[model samples]
Target: MSARSQRPGFGWAAPATVFFVAFGILPIAIVAYLSLTRWNGLGSPEWAGLENWRALPDDPDALNGIKVTFLLTLLCWLIQTPVSLLLGVWSAGRQRSRAILSTVFFLPLLLSTTAIALTWLSFLDPNFGLAASLGGSSLLSSPHQALYAVAFVIAWQFVPFHTLLYQAAARQIPTSMYEDAELAGANTLRQFFAITLPQLRNTIIASSVLIVVGSLTYFESILLLTGGGPGTATRVLPLHMYIKGFVGFDMGFASALAVLLVAVGTLLSVLIVRSTGYYRMASDREGFL
Candidate 1:
């Protein structure tokens, strides 16, 4: 048979499209409808008719949630990308010790998120955790320090995953490129800047999109760690939405926040992809091939 004759048809996408509509698009549609009605997780939803949407402009917590979410997202990118890049490049070396150490470094990604959060929660406990043992003032209880602490813990948890991405991408850089640079008397640092970073451009953009969008749903760690506590210092959008919907029983407003969350995450991912031309999956070696 001709290659074209055996190619998958449009029918191949039906299962995935149906699944996305049922679970993904359908949930968003329901939430959008819920945002227009006042539901308290009890009786039938009353027609709120933009009351929740209008209040979003004046809601202190919602606004702060947006700010904090972006702040954390930025922090994650700043903390993870460079560290991951450095470690990934280093670990890409074909050495026994590098492989062994890379395995250890990736342990965090293997652990359960709840277990990791709870472990950190205990470590940061003011009374008896490691933070107290260090004789430093309680990090988690201090509003000024808690957010930064959370960001650090987030980096600790997620950096390994991104590092793995960079490692794979780094290893794929044609050895000849580095050899050519070496022939030209380029130093390690110069070769990295000129070759590694440029070739990994696509991976960086892809990883960044994941980090920004994933930051929106960072509910469990913050929930388990601070419970949006120390007076809303670490209360990100997801936790803020949870408090409104479940704790405050303002489901309609929370639905609005969820819609906002969806909009912001989608926009951010789309913007990055569009701006960087990542959607084309452009190769750094386009002409080098």
Candidate 2:
């Protein structure tokens, strides 16, 4: 082969490569370094080796944060995925009602996260808020109810995005398949179970990866809604990291948590991709899974 032909296409990839190195690789390298040292964002970092990492196992608040983070991840998967799938399936058909319903379902995504959190915060406020009329304590003030309420808000905001994903995937299925299923004496529910769900497996897997990773990093809404209040009841890993780094002035420990969060998210994503046979199906363009 000619030298010219053997030359890699650096011209085409240079921009993206530069961006990845500058923004992605550089920040991660900094974080990795900071995770090994004690620095309170202002002073010179003092080398601490593995001290911060070792402390994670014995840290009660950190342990609780991990538990809460995983709980939120599971709750989001269970609640958002199914509901999004149903909405997507129902809206895949061209109907006026479906269009209206999809619009209503997606309206929440239009608002900012701060707005959504604050709105829910008001609704859950016991004094002069909507929940006041419910005649009991505010849900946000209750440790048991706070986490679930926050999870619901997160799911509500993102469900539309997931629904759009599934809707697009579902719509790509050939109409002939449904016709064949109808001719085979399949009912609507039977068709969905045999065909629609099967066809959407890859989409579901992909969406689940996004949701799981997002759940791990959810912070803003939680911060605004509950401030990880009611005594750490709703504090997730990201929120805990923020508190450690900024609020508590424990940057080293916070960096360790951040690294762990990234590691966990990456691990889960890889497992999902592999277990779902995503790599094997990647080259298939026919789209009929």
Candidate 3:
């Protein structure tokens, strides 16, 4: 073959390559470099070796932020996934019901995060709001209740997105399989276990990865709704990072935290993908490597 023909599609891949280099590779490289220094977002950065990284374990705020982040992730997963799956299954079974309910469920997703947070804030207000009649205690002000309340709102906004994903995946399942199960006198629950769940495995994995990664990086809504307070009760890692970088002006420490956040997110994504055997499934179906 000619040298030109044997070469890869460099011309076609140029834009994507440039974008990845500029946005992805460059930022990660910069953050990794910055993590090892002590800079206050002014003057020159002084080399601090691994001091910031070492301090992370001992830092109460960082530790609490990690705990809160994971807790929020767990709550979001528990609240959103099953409900989305159930709604997806239900909607898939009834076309007419699907149209109406899908619209209602997805409406929240169309609104901006700020708008959703503001709306929920009003609803949860202690006076003259919907929660006022329920003993009139402010949910957002109580440290114990604040995290869960914020998590619920986040879940409410995202559940429909997952539901739609599951619905699409469910629709891809062959109808004949369900018919065969029915012919054998299988009920809805039995058929679901035998057919639907197994077929939707890949979809579930994809949705879960998205949810976990998103949960880890949650910021804007939490910032607007709770401001990571009632004494740092709902302060997640991203919020902590923002406070450290912008508010405290500890650029280097925040960069270290940022790097750690990226590491944790990447590790979680990899572990979930591996455990779910997503790559193997993809390779089997599409000959992907």
> Which structure among the candidates has the greatest lDDT?
1
**Candidate 1: where is the Cα deviation over 4 Å?**
1-8, 286-289
lDDT score, residue 231, model 2? 99
Q: How high a TM-score does candidate 3 get? A: 0.91
Q: Please provide, for model 2 over 38-149, each residue's C-alpha lDDT reduced to its tens digit, 9 standing for 90 to 100.
A: 8987869999999999999999999999999999999999999999999888889998888988899889979999999999888888898888998867888899999889
Task: Find the candidate with the highest TM-score and give its number.
Answer: 1
> What's the ranking of the predictions by lDDT, best on top?
1, 2, 3
What range of 10 consecutive residues in model 3 has the weakest lDDT sum? 280-289
Off by over 4 Å in 3: 1-13, 283-289
- Which ten contiguous residues of candidate 1 have the minimum total lDDT? 280-289
Give candidate 2 regions above 4 Å deviation. 1-11, 282-289
lDDT of every predicted structure (CA atoms): 0.92, 0.90, 0.89
lDDT of 2: 0.90
- After best superposition, candidate 1 residue 73: deviation in angstroms? 0.6
Tens digit per residue, CA lDDT, model 3, 140-173: 9999999999999999889989999999888878
TM-scores for all predictions = 0.95, 0.93, 0.91
